[model samples]
Target: MGNRVFVVGVGMTKFEKPGAREWDYPDMAREAGTKALEDAGIDYRQVEQAYVGYVYGESTSGQRAVYELGLTGIPIVNVNNNCSTGSTALYLATQAVKSGQADCTLALGFEKMQAGSLGTIYDDREQPMMRHLLALAELQEFAMPPAPYMFGAAGKEHMERYGTTEEQFAKIGVKNHKHSLNNPYAQFQDEYTLEEILASKRIYGPLTKLQCSPTSDGSGAVIVASEAFVDKHGLADQAVEIVGQAMVTDMESTFADRSAISLVGADMTRVAARKVYEQAGISATDVDVIELHDCFSTNELLTYEALGLCPEGDGGKLVDAGATTYGGQWVVNPSGGLISKGHPLGATGLAQCSELTWQLRGTADARQVSAAATTSGVALQHNIGLGGAVVVTAYRPANR
Candidate 1:
């Protein structure tokens, strides 16, 4: 690392269902970006560069989004890496500061999506997920609405291979929905019993409507600055250091294994998590809070093992023991995760970043993890996209 990078500020808009709020991408960006700048106690002019992320927008949408903040002519790069778009932008911003390219940079992500399941935008050309779909088809029949079928099959594999039950998976939906009850920004704050989760309309194998993330419209922003900038701006007290971060793409094993678990980028998540832990000079046991990509309840269970929170095939046991919830070993998805918090693809990762930042700063309000429970003061984040990209990040107070 060249210069230590710190997240000086973070902000996000309330995640709402698609069309529930009358706002466009620009409006979302303006709200989140302005709040972040204010939180950092800096002006937009102070940002030397920016990386904006959005999935369903025109080519210059990034420039248009940032124009809502200022017209400084700063370099603006638009990013779209499927579901991981938000963190990909964040990864670039952190690299800019870490490599000494710029003292300060901004990472912003927003999305305005249509309600319902996601589908391919262009039918005339090759779909990005065709290869993964083909790989999955080799094991089981392809089902309608690719997202649920893909993750749901992985859940089925877990059930067959490890004796994981449908009730174990339903527990994740229940926990996340209950967790969302405290998060004012979450799209779905209503709590549900495990019976309620299991009884919801089934979308795929062992997966129900309540277990899947809903389409959402929202934006999130994070301001990253160098150590020097933090001291100069008197932000050291609140700065959260980016101690370790790594991004990994699909590995050969992703396809070679022919397992539904690996087919959904579990290997990518494992590799990325290992790299982040190695970089931070810590182990999985050292982490306190986590905000992972739980686009589906099944994905959340798979991630528990992928992130080394438990041994392979023991994720169900971990869930059964309640090791991942509050009053347990680590509080995973304190923000309700994607399943309940909402999944606006472009903004998901930034929302994770914002939540973890607030947790480390002890400012998450009702959703705050108990200070005693977060004794390690280390927060871990995992965000992955299906076309094959995963970003794992570790954060702690700068003074630590």
Candidate 2:
């Protein structure tokens, strides 16, 4: 990497469902892109390259937006990496700056998830392989051929093994929904208790309707510039540097083995976190807030283990103690996460980054964490693969 990359601007559109999948996504994307540019106080023309993140958007979606936004001079690349598509765009944009290919780059995550109901980041080059991989994941998770509920069986087995109560999982639903109540941009907002969550219709095994993230239509964007560029532009005082980032992918699907509560937390997350720790010169204790990938209640339970927030098989303890809550140690999903905030696969990753940046900058008004006494907030984002492709990214405020 060349010196370092800094994020100077961020933008996110309110999650909604009113636009066409392909065309409407671009409109929302342009709105988000303009917001990011304005937030940085830089002209849209300054954006040298654009990397668009979308799990289900059509090909060259980035270019389409650029053309619509009247910025066709630069290269716009489309990225499709399943749920981690947004982060993949961030990673690529960071590289563009770090590699000196561009001083200022645009990293955008925009999608009409409801338009593309079947969630995925498809690449025709290897669609068969990806499909085969996902199908195999479904197969591995179920013994019966072509079972409808691949994740359900694992959820049930996890409850049986860990003695995890339905209430425990429902508490997660309650917390996120409560948090979402304060989020104006969130898609789902209502009050529900553990009993309500349990009483809700079952989507899979132990997973109920309340436990899953809603399909969202939204956009997230950030502008990353090199240290030299920030200094030259007199933007060093306002930029947030990419202190450390670690992204990894697992070949196995999540359903294969539900015995491990930590899942990738122990293997992938630990390794990735350790790498970022070495790079950022910090530990889990130093992190002030974490915006995790909470697509399901059980995922967060396992994350507490994988992220080293608690001992093995004791992730539930962290929740019970309120460690994952806003006022607790290292608040988790202060933005209400995917379940409450809505999970537009493409936009979710950058949305996490945007929320992290705002919290670190202390710009979150009503939902802000007060008295934390930490401007040096450590932000963590988790983006999971369809089966088990998990990518972890961490950040710190550069201006602070």
Candidate 3:
């Protein structure tokens, strides 16, 4: 790295159901971006560049959103990478600081989504997910709502191949919903029993409605700066360094293996995670907290193996052992994950960044990973989107 990159500030709005809030994207962006700037104790003019992420917005929305912050005449790039859009923006901002191209930059993500299961918005053209859809078609019949079917099939395959039980999957839903009870920013904060989760409306395969991530409206922002800038601003105490990050797209096995898990981007997550660990000079065991993509409960189980948290096919065992929750091997998704925290597409990844930063700073209040568990002082984040991309990131307190 040419220069160390630090996240000096972070902020986000409470995730809400698609139509639950009357505000528009600009309002979301302003709230989050303003908070970040205030946290950094810097003015918007200090930002040399910006990368804004969104999935369901029109072109130039990035410029429109940032206008609420300032008209600094800085370069602004709009980014769209499905569900990983938020992290993609953060990745770019990190690069800008690491490459010494900018002393300070802003990564912002926001989404104003429509309610209900996500459907193709552009029906007249070739859909972007056609290839992934074809791969899934080779394995099983298509379900009416595609997301549940896709990830649910992956869970089904894991069960058949590894003897993972449906109860194990439901347990993930229970764990995340319970975790959300402590997160004010989470969309769903109520706790549920494993039986209640299993008995909820079945969407596809082994998945229940409670196990799925709801469409959400929210925004998150991070201010990234070079180490020199952090020192100059006297923000070392609050800064979190971006130690390692990698983004991977679908590999050949995603299509050729005819495995639903691979088709759902497990390999991508594994590859990206491996690269991140190498860059950070640490193993999975070194991570104190995690906020992985749990867009579906099944994906969380699948990701445990992909992230090297456990051996392949042992994800169910890890879950049963309670290895991923508080007082376990690691505290994963203390932010309630997507299943409970809400998945606002573009905002999801940056929201993960915000949570992890708070975690490293020991400012997460009720949901903070315990001091005993956080001795390592490292946090990991995973965010993915089908059609498909995955971004894995590692963070630690800058003062460390």
Task: Show model 1 residue runs off by greater than 4 Å.
Answer: 372-376
lDDT string, candidate 2, 215-282, tens digits: 77888899999887788888865677788887776534322443333232335666667787788888
Question: What shift in Å separates residue 68 of candidate 1 from its native position after superposition?
Answer: 0.4
Between candidates 1 and 2, which one is better according to TM-score?
1
lDDT tens digits, residue span 1-400, model 3 = 5799999999999999988988999999999999999999999999999999999999999999999999989999999999999999999999988998999999999999989988887899999988888878878888878889899999999999999999999999999999999999999999999999999999999999999999999999999999899989999989998899999998899898889999999999999999999999999999889999999999999999999999999999999999999889888899899999999999999999999898888889999896522435999999998988999999988877
lDDT of 3 at 214: 97
Could you give the C-alpha RMSD of every candidate to the true structure, in order shown?
1.0, 3.6, 1.1
The positional error of residue 373 in candidate 1, measured at the CA in angstroms, is 8.6
Give each model a TM-score.
0.99, 0.88, 0.98
Model 1 Cα RMSD, 1 decimal: 1.0
lDDT, model 2, position 300: 72
* Superposed model 2: Cα runs more than 4 Å off: 18-23, 115-151, 251-266, 371-373
